[model samples]
Target: MEERKKFTFSRRGFIRTSALAGGGILLGVNFLNACKESAQPPVNIANLNFKEFNAFIKIAENGYVTIFSPNPEIGQGVKTSMPMLIAEELDVPWEHVTVEQAGLDTENFTRQVAGGSQSIRHGWEPLRQTGAIAKQMLIQAAAARWEVEPYTCTASNGVITNQAGKQLGYGDVVNDAALLPVPENAVLKDPKDFKIIGKDAINVDVHKIVTGQPLYGLDYTAPGMKYASVLRPPAFGQTLKSFDASEAKKVGGVIDVLKFGDKVAVIANNTWAAMKGKHKLTAQWNDTTLESTEDHDAKLNAILNGSKFEVRREDGNVNSAFSEADSVIERTYESPFLPHNCMEPMNFYANVTAERIHLVGPIQTPAGTAKRIAHVLERDEKEIDLEMTRMGGGFGRRLYGDFAEEAALISNGAKLPIKVVFSREDDMAAGTYRPAIKYRIKAALKDGKVTAYHLKEAAINSNMYGLIPHFFPAGAIKNYKVETGNYQSNITTGAWRAPYTNFLAFAEQSFFDEIAKELAIDPVKLRMDLLDNVNDGEDERIEYSAARMKETIKLAAEKGNWGKAAENVYQGFAAYYSHNTHVAEVVDITLQNGFPKVEKVTVAVDCGIVVNPTGAINQVEGGVIDGIGHAMYGNFAFDNGKPKATNFDAYRLIRMNETPKVETYFVENNLSPTGLGEPGLPPAGGALANAITAATGKRMLTQPFIEHFNTDTREVRG
Candidate 1:
């Protein structure tokens, strides 16, 4: 009989036994076969966790596993994808594990952010090190028990087995293992042994999503919670001069109407009451000078009309290239101020007490928002706590914490727990917008082959701008002159889904379409020839691997039957590299009662070391539809310096009927991972534009391409 080694678990819930689960419902996940040493059950699950915690570890008395993750999920499938990474290296069956959110501790973790498509790639190192260290301690304990060499003993799935097959489960000998020192250099598992890491695990929260469970920020309900609304000026830079709040206060359930510098807060017993109070409050606005969304076009035009500014990248003589060309084609493209329009509106709940403040919301950056709150409240950073809820959708809208600050202020002013709820209208009107962009693209093709190209871009700056250098540097372009400028608008614009790449793709890929038509060459072959001619992403230029670009172009063409002909379907192709991955798309479009309808889209992506292929593919499919929606009808326009497209009625969003059939394929690559969230976006507009051109034989150089659109409604206010 083997001597039983007593062990204790520090985790908070009942974990499954080591035994695997049955198939079908439990296809990807199986139950853990739990083994007990000296049974002292684990800590209460509630004691082990509270809101706003991620990335902690615990030991089960009956030896199981505990892991805490700090990021929130808005359907990017990080919950299932991230945990799969930990379980792979820990060699613990997924069912045997119990996960809890880690507390806010700066000393132990970095800022827990989920945007920028950096989730899995960023988490790879720290998590693997943790698993390796634990494996070393377990081996040492087994060596001491059997009086054998530590290296000779093998540990698999929480079991320590000697060369003779005399084994001890983790729980059986953890006390001895806990006493042993942590190893500095423990070997990691080989990639071939990773059964779970690269697999396409289903979303862990799919059940909750499909069941209509209360998982979003808007679904939050707390004891004695009140609602608050704010009265903001129309335009971005406009401010409130004075307001008559007496009418607002007279309404039923309207508690108080408090004034803050340029804004007014309406606190009431319910969301409806606050909304009612907001309407009654008559505020006198001063639009001394403000830029309406309409002014975006004129303002950008003025900036581009000015002299150019240097950004980076120079290979050959660009000035001489254009001068020597026999003929040149120059066209300017425009992208409007678009909204993310995520399903969940912008909201945040705050319970601010005298000493400490509790903040809860569906935000992208919790740790960063907490710090911002500390600065605004003038309190110690540690006193401010965040409880993150799952976002219905983020699309980069949650990156800003102005809504959280609004909640904190309303809670403090009203002297009650307050949930600041932005109505769909208010969300569309007052929220940060995607900056508008305009690009002047020029190309010179001599003897049916491309010779020289020059592009000048001018758009809003003092707004949402990525590094910009990384995607367009010498590595990404050769002899390409990109001059971008920003025309400040009153509309509060920030990062939208895919950030700056959305507009860049619209302009860059659309220009590529025009260039292809000029040379009278097949667009796919032209791109391939250009790719063969230059290196967009290389070590000397930034090392953007084009193998994926080549793979995806081939895939989309083959899948969509690019060269093949069909009567109703018009085909278009475009490729781009962003978010660390290269993607190519072939779009098929047809006219539906004069409305340009995207029928189908074929996508090929190289995201490298895909952790979840299904989820990644889903992003591409969804993102392509989102891109089409923006190109066709989506707009966040303004009226008299105030945003006019305030709700779904005025501001259109993508819906089920509008979505096209999207087929996505992944390139098999062993390179380091890249972002998948925004990589598929850049090709949507160009492909659609090409399809539209093929269908109608009309060139679209402007956004919304309203000329081709059939609508009874006149032009919008902005």
Candidate 2:
């Protein structure tokens, strides 16, 4: 086991404390390592004694503790889990703690974005140290009052007791502790002594979310704020030419119509009036460069066939190994563009005045978005005040701040506070989609063992990042090569969930199964043999731990009863490592009425210590369901640059009845925690595809499995 690093204060004194006006304490700790500069004492503002701090823990006279969570809450449960970290080390009872969301504070916070599942992994040590230091200060104050050494007193569960059994509550000595010097070091609790780290905790906002409270961006409203509905180009490759809004002005409650760049914004007192007025406007568009789905397919195929490629990774003599192979197996897989389909449509509230810019709503990248708004409005970044609201869902869609920028621009142009809203059609048609991609994989088998492997990817807009080629199977194969090519298009594309690995995992895992069949070996055994070839520290670029991955694979197989299911029950298996976590899954299915009926999924994860088991389970279960739903039925396409489906009525999603029961297990360990949000998804598709092939003698090489097979008569379709 790796030795854990001890948390120590910097030589410049990283902790600052201030006395509350009415006999309490406010402790501010610099949780970031880069913040070495001395911090000024927090000043009282508007009678609120607590100022902006990296992580604030305020103790009132009544012994209630409030911890401000610095990161945005995007349904990943950080609002509940992060506060648990601080409360654990502070020795405060869970019921006495209250969690609150903190505003953007660039001076104190770092890496506040919510795109990656990195909140807990990054906040583990520093947040615990914050609570530990506060406890030490309170202990010293109690020892001073007793006229004895601090080592004689112990603090636990909001109380400090001396060796003689004299006790004092934290609230009774908070004022005295606030005036003492900050301690440079405080001992963190051992894992066995932990009271709140690995336990199940309810979501802080569950009651508000379930009771229909105003918590999401669409639910947020400001005083004197007008509603806006913008009209953009109808197609991907089109630009607005001219607009006529005279008819729109005659609508009731229509305040005004303003044009910004190529988009027209309809302003009104209510959302319904704004949407109604926007529908009445007429516009002309230039579609000379419009491209269709057929165009994209042809271009991608051409790239795949051509020799113009950027080699991402190259091992020993791939060509020579292929030439000497006994046989070669090759296949191609394809996937179409996908929308994020967030439950709440894109919306933001902005008030841009001459002196300051106030922005609020659901945004993943708050500080970065504030900077972009400053650049767009030609104001200093310091003039912007940004706050984050709970999001219905992000899934990498809120990472882009275009909606926020639109709100700021509209408010600035109309000289009024504005909240921009997107209708269902607008959200779908104007979304930044997942890039369409095609992957070709080939492997050479010689002397009953795999000898060589090659993979080539052709994508629209952008190719996979450099690190993806170095993931699993790179160090295991002696002769391996990965090449990529791309064709740039006008349509926007960016990160979606796990990004490249989401589809890449399915393609590679399926290819491995085919190789296993040709070699007449069990699918799980084939993977174990490949993993045995990889050694720790052989290559610095390999991020996965072979021992940990093997453990998860074994656990999943044992729990899933691999190769031991009853008659007519088919099983498929897949394992992958991504987002600093290792996951393995087994899919169990039974055919019903010529259609695949998923029954259950067994998953094993090695993400180190589990923080908040309830939240962790929710994330894994949600990922599995999302992966299966998209793989089985999700489909999106474009005709002449126009989206084919604009609403849920046309686009199909997996219904509640189709969702399978998920059984999850974790490989318990003492290592630091890793990400859990996306790792569970990458393996689900591959496992499901393999199970479908086991049931029916057909391999699915395309997404939306519904397209390649007939649901009515169990026959292969075009």
Top-TM-score candidate index: 2
lDDT of each: 0.70, 0.87
lDDT score of residue 300 within candidate 2 = 91
Q: Who wins the lDDT comparison? A: 2
How close is every model to the real structure, measured as TM-score? 0.88, 0.97
Q: Please write out the lDDT profile of model 2 over residues 227-273, one tens digit for every residue.
A: 99999988888888999999999889989999998899999999999
Q: Model 2 Cα displacement at 320 (Å)?
A: 1.2
Candidate 1, residues 377-430: lDDT per residue as tens digits?
Answer: 787877877777888888888998889988987787778899999988788777
List the lowest-lDDT window of 10 residues for candidate 2. 42-51
